[model samples]
Target chain A: DAGVTQSPTHLIKTRGQQVTLRCSPKSGHDTVSWYQQALGQGPQFIFQYYEEEERQRGNFPDRFSGHQFPNYSSELNVNALLLGDSALYLCASSTELAAGELFFGEGSRLTVL
Target chain B: AQSVAQPEDQVNVAEGNPLTVKCTYSVSGNPYLFWYVQYPNRGLQFLLKYITGDNLVKGSYGFEAEFNKSQTSFHLKKPSALVSDSALYFCAVSPTLAGGNTGKLIFGQGTTLQVKP
Candidate 1:
């Protein structure tokens, strides 16, 4: 089965610009969660999308938003990007919303200049 | 809030020697702990998790982690480390929410494991 997949393996954006990163959950999975991993740091939870609605969110600002489609694919949108927004965006998929093992994609590397 | 701490920023070990990456967690109720490995420019790969039952859980790549409830620590171990075992290791904890289990993970700063030849 195909694992989690993410688009725009690498992306470059300017400050004040908006960027969207896409993700397709693993086969047979429905829940999608986004995470941000900064250099030399572990990933920080961004938010989770279930049933086409945001179910859980982390401490991120309003600039960070996400959407889940009926097909279980997800998109993470970052508005007014800052230089500090440069990081690896990881998308994880799980079979359920409860405690379960997560399968991750290769991730989209966002470089905000 | 749930959190994890990786005490060592880096760990050096020779090939053929056993390796251990330390991790400690803080959370209320039953803590669901996990270990993930990340290669350069890659996503985090699930190694193992400790939900309940056996304290020792074995995972892919011959990796094993011991869950110590008393110490609130889960250390990853490998018996004969290889050069390819070098990678960034992260420990995470899933907080049991009052609403329900969200499976949201709180990760540590991460530790770099350098297995030398």
Candidate 2:
């Protein structure tokens, strides 16, 4: 089965610009979550999407938003990007039956200039 | 509040030697601890988890973890180290705090394991 897949494996953006990253969940999975991993640090949860609605969110600002399509794919949008926003963006997928241990994608490396 | 801590930044061990990565968590109520390994430029792979069973749980790639409720620690262990096992290790906790799988995971800083051949 195909694992979780993310688009634009790497992206570059300028400060004050906006970017959108897409993710497709693993086969047979429904829930999609986004995380940010800085150099030498673990992944931090950004938010989760279930049933096409954002169910839970982390301490990110309004600049960070996400959407879950009916097909279980997800998109993470960052507006007014900051240099600190430069990190490896990860998309994880899981099921309601086992919502804890998530399957992650290769991730999108975001570089803000 | 829920948090996870990995005390070691890097762990070095010779081949065939045993290995251990330390982790501890802080959360109210029950904690669902997990161990994941991330190879360079790859996604995180699940190693093992402790839900509500015996303190010891075995997982993929000959990895295991011991959960200590009193200490609030879950340490990953391997009987023998392999050069291929070199990667970044992360520990996470799911706070079963009366929410329906909000899916917010608190992760450790990460431990780099270097298995010398």
lDDT for each residue of candidate 1 in B26-53, tens digit (9 for 90 to 100) = 8898878899999987788999988899
Residue-level lDDT of model 1, residues A1-113, one tens digit each, is 88999999999999999999999999899999999998888899999988899988999999999999999999999999999999999999997844757999999999999
- Candidate 1 Cα RMSD (Å): 1.3
Q: List the residue pairs that clash in candidate 1.
A: none
TM-score each candidate.
0.96, 0.98
- lDDT of model 1, residue B110: 95
Report fnat, model 1.
0.76
* Candidate 2 regions with alpha-carbon error over 4 angstroms: B99-101
Rate residue B2 of model 2 by lDDT. Answer: 78
